[model samples]
Target chain A: MEILTQIFSLETLSSTLRMATPLAIAAIGGLYSERSGIINIALEGLMLAGAFIAVVVSYFTGIPWLGLLGALVFGGLFAMIHAVVSIKYHADQVVSGVAINMLAAGGTVFMLNIIFNTSGTSESVNALPYWGPFKPTVYIGLLVVFIAHYVLFKTPFGLRVRSVGEHPHAADSVGIDVEKIRYICVGISGILAGLAGAHLSLGVLDSFREGMTAGRGFIALAAMIFGKWTPFGALGASLLFGFSQAVQIRLQGLGIPTEFVQMIPYIFTIIALAGVIGKSTPPTAIGEPFEKGKR
Target chain B: MGVDKIDIKELAIELLIPLLAIIFSFIIGAIIVYTFGYDPIETYAALLQGAFGNLNRFADTLLAATPLIFTGLAVAFAFRCGLFNIGGEGQLLVGGLAAAWVGTFDGLSVVVHVPLAVLAAAIAGAIWIAIPAVLKAFLGVHEVITTIMMNYIAYAMVAYLSLKVLANPGEIKTPPIEASAYLWRFSNILDIRSYMNLGFILALLVLLFIYYLLWKTTIGYEIRAVGINPDAAEYGGISAPKNIILAMLISGALAGLGGAERTLGLYHYYIQGFSPGYGFTGIAVALLGRNHPFGILLAGILFGALSNGRTFMNMAAGVPIDLVNIIQAIIIFFVAADLIFRQFIPNKSEGGVA
Candidate 1:
């Protein structure tokens, strides 16, 4: 009973929510891009860029919100690069994504070493002002999730986006701007992912670390799939993953083997992904770049 | 198409694109280095010297290329079969662990023990990818998403086992393999004290085997057919699902063998960071090689040289190792955009894709 009590404690609940927040935000970002027929594997890299830029700007400006804004702008810009290479230039989506990841990883490390004279980490910067013991930003994330869901499912623009993902050629024949929709969707993905990164640096840790986003973007991708690409479903999946991570941390505190505990979330993710694999379907045109002339 | 006629013009055009891409990327790298107050020419010269300056350094380059050849081949094999096996890292980890397990156990003769360990690693790798294969084949799931997810799972599992269950009682690594199972290293003659070993030969054999398997067999034909057009393959009576699973299994086995080589030959024990992103780098290598076996071999060696030389470049010319990474990224970007350059250059054959 005591063990159960500890497991179900308020601290555990809050920590779980906190851990899930970044993943939830990133998953929502993934949902937008993927639903619109673009596979945004670069979310991880984008988030890292956001986190780094947020810290750098915040460090210089001494305002956390500005840091957040900076991240959002840069993240969007990075996504634009993806849009140009994939949507305009007709580059392979997967390869373009890989390029972005490599660029982000190498670029951030390079910038860190050159500008900050550090490796794998940056100096602690002034964090965004916390709203309370529980930050108001968490609520903002939830609100954005709901808003994004509403926009994706209920709006006319959402329908067009969905159509483009299902069959761009058909969508084009029907007079929908396939390229435009993809550009917007990808751009939105960047903004949301950037916010997630900003939250990591300014809200969670108040500093940037190299590879801090680690595989969280991939985890969010998994959550998006496990959630079947629906916004609410993605949230549920993110919470589940977050809960696993929270449990791992708690178990670590109890002197349980930390390594085994660390494996729990990843193991659960793999199992869940495998189980959901054949059953769930991604958007039809997920990886295929939209070529204007091709049938 | 006349096989006898050599179209020099077409060949030159084809060469133009890759050449321009390389030149463009180099220019970008030079600018970045110049921004840092470093001379690009001197830095690159130093890089060359460090990578191939001496026989010892050249050996080191080959050593680094050894496992990469396997991993790159593994990735390219899957690509040819129309599956994306991003789980190479995970497969490698499991395979490494299996080989380590077999190696630490004493009793068997060298001939039997070594082969057994290698087979176990291959089996372990095959099993690792089997789940995703089943998902993709039966449920219509994409391998890209599933394989990526599995990579994390594999990493975590390895970390868990290495830190607790499989870890040596007093160390963070597993027990070293028995002498009988150990791979023969040629460091004694090289006098360089580097870890390069006979695994390079094994890597070469695997590459040749992959070339034969992919191009010389009926199964290879079916796999390639499925990759080009799965529906056509299915219509022609080739089971797409079976082929998918088989390809993944083969790819995983190769990756597993790569891992085993690293453990039994070089490291002598399993440890964290054993790979250092070899799995991801393999993706770049496979792409640069254009998914051809011979191309993969050349690309693998080039990457190995760059990686080995980066350290030397850092020490000799004070050029940051990050520059090499930038160059690598550029190479991948250009290769991925190879078609873009194709428009400019008509067709000229380069040595190989890499």
Candidate 2:
């Protein structure tokens, strides 16, 4: 009972929320892109770019919101590389994403040396002010979730995005531009991933570190998958993973093995994907390039 | 049979595309280098010298290429069957752990112990992938998600086992295997002062085996048939589900063998994070090689040289090692979307951006 209370404390819940914020933000962004029929595996790269850019900008300007703006521009521009190659050039979606990740991991560190004259990490920078128990970005992330749910399900734009994902040819027959919708959704994904990255560097912890996202973007992908590509589903799934991460952190002082503790969320992910939850189908037209006048 | 006519034009184009991608990437790299106030020529020259200047350096390059050859073949084999295998890292861990665990056993003959350990490693890797394969073939679940998740799980599991069950008293790593379980080193026969080992030969034999299996056999035909059109292959009485599992098993085995080579031939123990993303690099190698066995071999050697020479480039030119990374990524991006450049080249034979 004592252990359960300690595990279920308000502080732990808050930390869980804090951890889930970035994941939820990133996953919701992915939900848009994936639901719009383009795979957004470059979220990891975008988030890393956001984190790096946020730090550098905030370090210079001393204002967190301005840093957030930098993340959006840089992240959006970085994601356009994937967008152009995948949507415009008809490159393999998976390969484009993998390339983005490799680029982000390497490019961020390379920039670290060029700009900061340091490798592996950046110096301490001015951090975002927290409001009460949470950072402002945390609240913004949750707000975005609600807004995304509305935009994805309640609006005509949402219906078009859904229709585009379900059947691009059918959508095209109805006069919707599939490529334009994909480009916009992917761009939005970059923006949200940027926000998520900024929260990591400015909100959760001060300064920047190489590969600071640390598979959170991948975890966000898993959350997106686990949530069945729905915004609310993404929220619930993120919390579940967030809870496991919370537990892992809590278990550090115990005699239990750290590796086993860390395995909780990943093992849970595999089980959920395999069949603990019902089968989650992807968008029908997802991962296929939009070609005009083709069958 | 008459000697096949060497179409030098076709050959030139085949080689020229990748060469152009490399040169383009280097140009971009040079811009980045110049921005950082470093000379690109000096950096590249240092890289070449470090990778191939001496016999010892060449041996190091081969030693580095050994594991890449295994993982590259792993990815290429699966690609031939139209499967996306992002789980090589996980498969490698299971195989390495199995090999390490088996190698702990003493009082065995060299032949018996070594083969036993390697076989265990292969089987372990196959079993690890069997889960994703079953899920993919039967449940229609994409292997990408399952395999990526499994990679994290495998990392955690290995870390746990290595610390709790397999660790030597003071070390963070597993106990070293018996000398009998060690692979025969090439340096022994060559009398070279390098770490080159029999793993290189093993990688070559596996490469040949994959080539034969994918081309000469009925199974290969069926796998390729399914890859081209699953519905048609099914209509022709091929079991798509079975081939999926079979291909994943073979791919997993190859990746696992890579792990075993690193453990038994190089480290002689299972160390944490032993791979250094060889499994991920396999994807780039396989794609750049166009999924052919010989192509994968050449791509693997090229990447091996890049990795082996990055340190010299860093030390001599005062450039960061991440330049290799940027170049690698640019290469993949260009290869994946070569139509970006193919448009400029007047190739009447090619279609626009398919």
Candidate 3:
């Protein structure tokens, strides 16, 4: 009973919201790419790049908002490389994503060495301001989720994205410009994933550390899958994972193995994919390149 | 005879593309180095010197390449069956734990104990991948997501077991394995002071075994047939699901052997975060090698050199070690999308990207 109260306390709930913001935002980012028929496992890299960029910009300019803007712009440009490789060159999407991740992992540290002469971390920067109990990025995260839900399900652009994912040839027959839609969708994912990264560096903490995202980008991918690729579903899934993380943090001193607690979200993701929560299918042509005039 | 000529020509192209990719990546890496105000020639010279300046340094390079050969082969073996096995890291970790556990057994002969520990590692790795393989084969779940998820689970499980259940008092690592389980180091035969072990030989043997198995066996034929076209292979009476499971099991075992090599041969105990993304580096190796057995061997060696020599580059040339990783990523990009090379080739024959 005591544990139950501790788990559901106001502080824990607020922590849950804070923890879920990045996952929800990143999941929405993944939803955009996967829904447009591109398998983007590069969210981790994009988020890392964003976190690094946010810290660097904030450290230089002394404005957290401007840092967030820098992250978004750079993240999109970084993702465009994946876009060009996978879409134009017809590379395997997963392999391309792996390369993108490696680039970010190496590039960030390389830049850190050059810019700060430190290999492990950056200088602390001004963090994003909080409004009420939560940071503004948290509110922006929620707003992005609702907007993603509307834009993905209710708009003509959403219809075209969905069609391109389902059957690019059919969408191409109708002059929907399948390749262009995929490029834009992948770009949008990069932007949102960048926002998630900024939230981590500028919202949750004040500086970027080496590999600090620590597979949260991957957790977001799991959330995107667990949510069945819907924005609202992703939000719900993120909250569940966030709740687990919150509970884990609160339970740290109570002799519970923290490693097992950490395993909860990932193990749940595997179980979710194994169909315990009903069948979750990806976009029909999710990993395939949009080849024009081909069967 | 004509078919043989065509086969040789095809093999030449297969080899040429990867070679081209490596060269292009180096050129790009050089440009990046120059842009960063470093001397690219000096940086690369230092890298080569550090990797092979002496017998001792060359041995260190081989020691670094040892586990990579296993992981590269693991990835390549699964790619042959049209399955992407990205769970190598998880499998490797569990394998290390299993080896650590088995190596603690009391009073066995060196030969018996060593083989037993290695077998345990391989079996543990195979078991680690079983869930992902089953999910992928039977439920239509993509192995990429499942395997990656399993990696996190493995990380947690290994950390819990090593730190909580197996660690010696007040230390972050498991108890050292019995001396009987240790893989003999080359220092026994050579004057080198490095930790290079019989594991390098083991890696070469496994490489040869994989080559023979994939090209000379009925199992390899079916695996390749399925990889080429599962639907067509199914129509031709091969069981796609069964082959998928078998291939993944073997792949996992290979990755597990990599872990065993590190534990019994190098560390003699399961250490936390022992690997610096060797499993992930295996992906780059497999791609840069074009998924061929011999090619994987060379690619693994190249990456191993980069990893081993980066320290010298950092110390001598004032270049960051992370540049190796950037070059590695660029290599993968060029290799995966060979169309980037098509721009440079005049009147290239048309085919899908390999």
Candidate 4:
């Protein structure tokens, strides 16, 4: 009974919230871009860019919030490269995203080599203040989910974005600037992803390690898909994956085959994508480039 | 128009696009080098020298390329059939594990043990790929997400097996396979001190086999038909589902063969992190090669040269070898951005037609 109580304690729940925050934020980011008819597979790369920028800024400025701002700016700028490639250059969305990811992976380490005089990791910097084991961004991130839900469902801009995503021809006929909407949404998503990266660097860990986000950005993508691209659903899925992350650490302490435990969220994501958990449908124009005057 | 004229036109475009992409990549790399306060011309010269300095260096380049050829072909073959197999890394992992596991038990003769180990790897790779293929075909799940998920799972499973189940305690890798399971090195036969092995020959054979299969076989025709237009192929009585599954299996097998090369040819054991993003690099190789068997061979060799030379560039130029990866990334980005490609080239279709 004591073991069970300890296992289900608030501390474990708090850790789960911490783990989920990045995923939730990134998923919401993906939600906006996908809803605007662009595939944003560069989320991973954007997150990495953000993480690297956050750490570097925080280390230099001695201010964590400035790090977050720097991360957002860099992350948005990095994502713009993907946007130009996918939207203007008419690149295969997946390939462009993969390139962005590779750039982030390599470029960040390269920058680390220059900035910190090392390759694998950055210097340890001051982390963000905590509100009883939770960073301020944790609350901010969770709050953004609700804000995202409201804006996506309630606002006119949300309707315009959805219209562009679903039937671009119709949206164009209706005088909607599809490309403009897509650029904005993609930019916003990039900022969100950067914030998620900032959360990882400034909130969870003080230093940024190479590939430290590991597969979190990809996992956040899975969560977005698992939730059927809905902000609330994405939040729910992210929390679930986060809970699994918390449990995996606990299982490690119990001497279980913790490697398998580490795999649970990914496995669950596969199952979710397989429609065992629920059916998921992506935006109709998600991977299609919006060419003007073309049906 | 004469067939020869059309063929020449196609060839010109094909060669031009990749060349332009490479030039663009290096230009970007050069700009970045200058920004970082390095001499771009000197760096590129050093890169060239490092890659093809001598026979031994050339052999090292090919040795690095051997696995890439297998993995690149895996990605290219699948792409020919409209399937995106980002799961080559996972297939390679399982296949390597299978080869290592099979190698653990060996009193067999040379022919039997080597064949058995390679076959184990191929089958293991096939089995792993089957999961995603089935999920995609039957359940309407996208292969991209499933394959990516499988990669993490594969990594985790391999980590577990190597650490807990098959560990040679205190060593970071499993026990070295017996002599019978080894892939022979050309260097050994010639008494040269080099890692160059029979795996390059194997990569060459696989390339030829794939080229033949894609161009000559009825199955290959069906696969191409489905890839070009799945609905039309279905209307014309080709089973799109079946071809997708078959392509994935073949892709998986090719990747598995790569794993076999890594275990039997290179390490003689399944070391942790044996694959240094070779699977992902295969995607760029396939694209840069224009998904042609011969093109993949060329791209694979070029990448191998880049990989081998990166360390030399780091030591000689005071630049992080990560710059090579950045160059590779830029190349892939250009490949993806067809509009930019079209803008520069002016009158060419996508790579397939070119």
- Number of the predicted model whose TM-score against the real structure is largest: 3
Report the C-alpha lDDT of model 2 over A1-295, residue by residue, as the tens digit: 7778888999899989998999999999899999999888788889999999999999899887889899988888888898899998888888889889989988999889888888878988888897988999999999999999999899999999999999999999999999999998898899999999999999998889999998899889989988889999999989988887887855766666677766666666667777777767789998899998988
Question: Each model's TM-score?
Answer: 0.93, 0.95, 0.98, 0.96
Q: Chain A TM-score, candidate 1?
A: 0.93
**TM-score of model number 2, chain B:** 0.93
Q: Give the distance in Å from residue A146's predicted Cα in candidate 1 to where it truly belongs.
A: 1.4
Chain A of candidate 4 gets a TM-score of 0.96
Write out the backbone clash pairs for model 2. Answer: none
Deviation from native of the Cα of residue B328 in model 1, angstroms: 2.1
lDDT of 2 by residue, B1-354 (tens): 111246765567667767777789889989989888999899999989888878888888888888888888888888877888888888898899899989889999998998899988889888888988998888777787788777888888888888778996667889989998898887787756767788888899989988898888999888877777778889999999999889989989998998888888888999987887788788888878878789888988988888888889999998888988888899888888877766666655555332
- Model 3 docking category: high
Candidate 2: lDDT over CA atoms?
Answer: 0.86
Model 3 lDDT tens row, B1-354 = 221145655667678889888898999999999999999999999999999989999999999998898999999999999999888889999998999999999899998999999999999999988999899889989999999998999999999999989997688999999999999999999999889998899999999999888888989888888888889889999999999999999999999999999999999999999999888999988988888888889999999999999999999999989999999999999898887766555544476433
Which ranges of candidate 4 are over 4 A from the true structure? A253-255, B1-7, B346-354
Q: Top lDDT: which candidate number?
A: 3
Model 4 per-residue lDDT tens digits across residues B182-282: 89987876645668888899899999999999888999988888888889899999998999999999999889888998898888999998898888888
lDDT of candidate model 3 versus the reference: 0.91
Per-residue lDDT of candidate 4, residues A1-295 (tens digit): 7766766899888888999999999999999999988887788889998999999999999998899999999888888888888887777777888898899999999999888989887999878898866898899899989999988889999899999889988999989998889888889889999999999999999999999888899889988988889999999989888887887766777787878977776788787777776778788888888777754
